[model samples]
Target: MQRTRHWILRRLSHLDLILLALVLLLLGISVAVVASASGQSPARISGHLVNVGLALSLMIVMANIPPHLLSKVGPVLYVAGVVLLVAVAVFGEIRNGSRRWLNLGVMAFQPSELLKLAVPLMLAWYFQRNESGLRGKHFLIGGALLAVPFVLILRQPDLGTALMIGASGFYLLFFAGLPWKIILGGGVLAGASLPVLWGFLHDYQRERVLTLLDPASDPLGAGYHIIQSTIAIGSGGLFGKGWSQGTQSQLDFIPERTTDFVFAVFGEEFGYVGTILLVALYLSIVARGLVIAARAPTLFGRLMAATLSLNLFTYVFVNMGMVSGILPVVGVPLPLMSYGGTALVTLLLGMGILMSVATHRQLNKT
Candidate 1:
């Protein structure tokens, strides 16, 4: 019994308590918001709770694995992700005009979701392996590696996810110490190419951008979502109208109340005070992730942890921005708060990676 206790203490000492606490806190908030948003739908809330539990379990298991093992398998996993994405493009199921899912009898999944983590992991491994001798050519190669999956995803027409995948890879590149001049040059080129990109946008995509510019222009048409969402937020004011009593949500005035627009439901029920507290919680999670990355025992671990952490921040920012009408309406879900198996699984997997890195830090110190 004494020996078993000692072994448990040794393992516990390596656990990332702060990151775990943030994950649990955010998950608890997710359950509350989902319950309110779903109008207290028992089945949906229970499913989400089960998913969160699974995610936490996965995180604990991942935290115990060594960083080197993760790095070694990164490339193989990335290739598998690409193959899955390609397979989806060929024979995947289509829903709502996007062929992004594979129907696997018992469950359906999106390969693009896997790329979110796979892209970062693969790149981190690549950079760490090649960091002994960095060069412009290496940077360009990394950019190409990043761009391939990104272009494929964009062709799948999942712009939101493709952008996220690109962002994750770009974060890895930026941390690998890419040159400032190249970064500036890329920015200028992107700015200059906006016209070309705009020309190629699908009609609905164009309308989304226009809606952001003037939601009132098509009050009852393309702009209805933003218009309704803004009203929900505005009506909430300070302390909120009270949980499960939000008229916007209960009346179905706010579309996607349980998914992409879950934040609106949260804003309506919890108001500004709740919003501030929620944002603080998210920031704390990001901060803790940054700490883990900074203290990571190896370069690959550092890069992976930092990129994953920032990816979470970006998810929150983009989802809130799109829902609030500050940005073009893109179908980005609010992390754990949003309903959907793919996103929930993907996000939890990311947390798992963070836990792995944090655990590595603790192990190396001893």
Candidate 2:
């Protein structure tokens, strides 16, 4: 009992209060959005609350792990994530025209979410192991590892998640000190491959790109969501319409209001001021994450932490852009504010790993 108290005190001192406060603020905002978006669906709100509780518990557990242990386990976790993704490809349940979830009797799991963390973990471990002097071969091998799971996820036709995973891995490569010329060359190659990739996209995928090019062409078809979302955002003006009072959401003009389109709901009800405040909260989280990454005790910790931080930013950017019609509709959720068990869990787990890095740095500094 005495030893337990001592250990608790030692670990508790490392907690990042600012990050936690921002997280809680986001949670508070999420509850409001979920309630408004769900309209009388008590079940969804309850489920989200439960998921948040579970995720927070997991974050606490992750924060307790030592940096050395996290580094050692990174590869193991990565392999496990990859194996699960493979299993999902072979024997997964298909939903909404995509085979992305694995049923575990009681609940469904998305392995792609696991890859968001695992990719960074694996890359961090690899780069740290080979950090003495990286080379072209090392970059090639890293790209291959990232491409394997990315290809598998893309085959699942979950473009949003696949893109996130790819970004997470790419961040590690960038942080590993890859040359600017190589990076530019890779970008040029990707741009050149667009035509080939376009030829292979599914019908709906093609429609989305087309809609993005000219949203007014199909006002009631592929363009309905963006048009509606844009209206909601514009109507909010500067001060917003007030909570639970946005006509677009209240009248059900916005599809996926509680999920992908929640940001629209937020914009309609809270307006530009609300949007700015929300952005500030996200910015705070990102800033804290960068600090943790910069002060991380080792190369692996720094890479993993930075990748996770940037990945969170990508989630915000992509989701907001898609809902606003600046980007095509891909089913990316707005981090904690969106209602989905799998996404909430994945987000919280990523935060856990970030907290783990932050905790490690604090311990070492002491």
Candidate 3:
């Protein structure tokens, strides 16, 4: 029995079992919450489960990839993402006044999702190559690399995805030790450009910001989502009304209850206690990812792991804030908890890359 245990441990030494456990726990919670939120829709639950399966399969595959091979392919993946984004601009299908998806005969796909991983991967690879002497000009080059996809996705009018992708790249640059003077100067310029930014916002986008400031102004219109979500959350109290028993969701008052507002569903069903548990699980995953990043042997591995972890943090923070009415609705989904295949798959792939970094380093050390 001792020899068997030792053999198993040696075989699985590369895996971050704690992070894997956290991921599984979150996925379990997501499946349950999605089932409750979907109500009578059995297909929704099955589809979500299928997505989880596919995502997990991909995660395992990516976790086994060698670090050097990933570095070599990073630029290729990024270039592919850029090409897809351009294709969407020229020959994409329009949905609800936004050209964000490309219909490829059998299926429609969003290119912006690809940038979420590719941007960070490419940036990490770039900085890894220039690790010895990164200067102000190199930072400028990095910003330009970040801006191209950011602008393209923003043109797709997917502000949420564009911002998410841009944030991932920015995290790498910041982690690469960008100077404080540049950070302060950029902050000042961003503040000065506020009016210009407002001018560029679409009417609906502007309305979202206004609604965030004063949701009461359009309670039944623009502010309806926030109002209903908050009501659901507040009514759940300390112990909740019970699984699938929330009146707001069952009565069809909460909007987007399965996607962006799914957290609200979980909150209403399981209340404050459940929310605390879920948040802790999320933080554990983030913390574990950071530990892996800190232990990474190569600069590329460290940057990628850190950026991916922070990007996960951004998703959780934005989704919770949007649902709780603290931030403007940006359609950011709660990582792992939201019922969307694209975002879920992209996120899992990133976590897999982090796992790859950790495992690859361990294998090299052995």
**In terms of lDDT, which candidate is strongest?**
3
lDDT of 3 at 91: 97
Ranked candidates (lDDT, high to low): 3, 2, 1
User: How far is 73's C-alpha from truth in model 3 (Å)?
Assistant: 1.3
Per-residue lDDT over 256-276 for candidate 1, one digit per residue giving the tens place of the 0 to 100 score: 888999999989888999889
TM-score of 1: 0.95
Q: Residue 294 lDDT in model 3?
A: 95
Model 3: residues with Cα > 4 Å off, grouped in runs:
1-14, 364-366
Candidate 1 clashing pairs, residues 3+ apart or interchain: none
Question: Number of backbone collisions per candidate, in order?
Answer: 0, 0, 0
Instruction: Please report, in order, the local distance difference test score of every candidate based on alpha carbons.
Output: 0.87, 0.88, 0.90
Clashes of 2: 0
lDDT of 2 by residue, 103-222 (tens): 999988888888877788888888899999889999999999899889999998898889989988888899888789999998999999999999999999999999999999999999
Task: Return the TM-score for candidate 2, rounded to 2 decimals.
Answer: 0.95
Question: Which residues of candidate 2, in runs, are more than 4 Å off?
Answer: 1-11, 362-366
RMSD to true structure for each model, in Å: 1.9, 1.8, 2.7
